[model samples]
Target: MGDYTDKVKTKMEDLIENEKNQWIDLALKIHENPELSFEEHKATQWLTEPLEQAGFRVKRHLLPELPTSFFAEWTGTKAGPTIAFIAEYDALAELGHACGHNIIGTSAVSAAVSLKKALDDDLPGKLVVIGTPAEEEGGGKILLVENGWFDDIDAVMMFHPRDKTMIFRGSLACVDVDITFMGKAAHAAANPDQGISALDAMLHSFLAIKQLLPSLPASANVHGIIRKGGDATNIIPDHCEASFLMRAKTREELHSIKRRVYDAVRHSTKAIGASCTMEEGLIYAERINNRVLGYQLMYNLERIGVEVDSSEITTGIGSSDIGNVSQLVPTIHPYIKIGNAITHTPAFTEATKSPEGMAGLIQAAKALALTAFDLFQSPSLIMQAKEELRQTINQRRNRL
Candidate 1:
């Protein structure tokens, strides 16, 4: 079994290598045409084009609201585990693919295509590639999970390009709060006393939250930006809006933080004789990296001659929609080292199309394909992974 697995892995790697140029071109093209979240129509079309040509059955716009999202599947001759690859293609506003999503989306496509070619008609299980959009701002995966898109998948996997290569990392559970304050508007020179300044209330809220942060836990934090401050300095502002993103180690902790911050906003607005309302986005749950699958990925990564770094991510964590998907199925969002520059920056944007970036992309594709091959060849691994996910979920529920 080990020998056959090795041969299959070799074939998969060869397939990726032989067509590395084409894959590189695709990644570069995606980098050139950067699209924002939920508006990745071109990216969706480009990503699925190769899959459809390779004989995978394609479905576009799984959800009416999420029109850019899609699903492509290939069924085997026999019944087995269904493994799905999650693809993210949304770019940041103004930064234009600075987050390396171009690398991410293309790597998933290359991996799935190579794996299918290596196995051919001998595949024993189902393979699917899910195109998930709006990850940067909107919770695209959260919507898909709620709609039952991932209900039948046995395992899910995706790769992220980072400064370091790690298999297991923790992410914060997060939610965005949009706060709006309303007050009476009046001319500053004519009757300043008659006007209630909404900007004052917004500023007070920021101060109040800053004061509250010291009392909160180290793992919890709140960052905010003023979406609408005022129209002009000569006139008293009538309306103001501030957006805050609160994050914590877990959703429970995040909830507590939100309550405190909401209280602060209310009190601050009331003190300034203004009324305020808060709107929140979907809650992004903390990540639960399936140890069973993560270890398999680590092994395969090393087999491809890429050195494995520490498997545990203890600090410097952020939130992602993948965290929501990890809650349902055995999932791994492993990171491959692209360069020293971090994500969401101009330097990182350049690295996504650089030679080093291309190397990381190919490495990521090979590792993903090989690890997926492991799941198809060894069903016990899938069972163990699912059991691990069950235990983790139960433990989280007990804590709550």
Candidate 2:
């Protein structure tokens, strides 16, 4: 390795040793005080305090609509590329960090801070730590990218805690929709013929969706919940609310399946003499990974004694807001193992606070820090990442 590379590796090792306890403490604190999507006030405060103290100019982007999402930037003297370290801190509803976002938030903060310190003198670029909220619901990063937050960013990095470590595993395209059914209400025993039950409409819609399953592709998924049914047993329901999530491998495929779903909802409600309304919610695009950056990160992880299995790299059905960011910039959202627990469950919560969890955080921080150093030190890698991203986006647009 070159002298500059050696220096960065040395500094990363020292930073990991010095900030290990601090990171663990922060992770545990965030885990203990879990906050839901778009309400991560405590998490935002916890992450930004350290950045401000480290002499970085912190700016809060408060949208009149979205209060919890924000971005912080730290610039170095030498002019080069801007690298963003994305952090997510939203907890699942009632699950309380079951997805291990506490580790994600702390690991990102640790990586950004270590990178900042490593390049404090004679640095070549800028370091940005972006606190993204509501990955569980709102897709906050999608809004940020839409508003041009990532316009100048060259590369983005973040790690999620999973059962194993691997390179870029592509994610599915997803759309969340809220469906409401309205009908006339009357006494079930006295005027049953005069009542149009909204619950009956919902049942028809569910049955239609069940039949659609056989026609859907292997990559397609449809899931939903009936949020509201009725008030009492003797009264015909006047209104019913249901929410659904649709997923597919590509946006085109997602759109195709979504049309069938909408038709199902419309026909079912029409047959029951009930009107229906559909409201769009979070829509996540599929992740487009930068292969050049993926290989570079894999190399850095191996240098740090993290063995990543190639056979483990596969497409994931779950979606993320990071997918939105990847569409705009070159990005990598690699997963590092905490333990063998299934994510989004109580067992995952326990594993996230374990000793193994702390170790995984440190390892991820080191790998991310090293990868950032490589981007700053080696211009070729950064150029290749950008070029790959440009080509991928162009190809996708052409297909569209």
lDDT tens readout by residue for model 2, 293-322: 788889888988888954434455588889
Best by lDDT: 1
Report model 2's TM-score to 2 decimal places.
0.93
- lDDT per model, in order? 0.93, 0.87
Candidate 2 ranges with C-alpha deviation above 4 Å: 397-400
| Per-residue C-alpha lDDT of model 1 across residues 157-271, encoded as one tens digit per residue | 9999988899898898999989999998999999999999999999999999999999998898799999999999989999999999899998888989999999999999999
Error of 2 at 151 (Å): 1.8
**TM-score, one value per model:** 0.94, 0.93
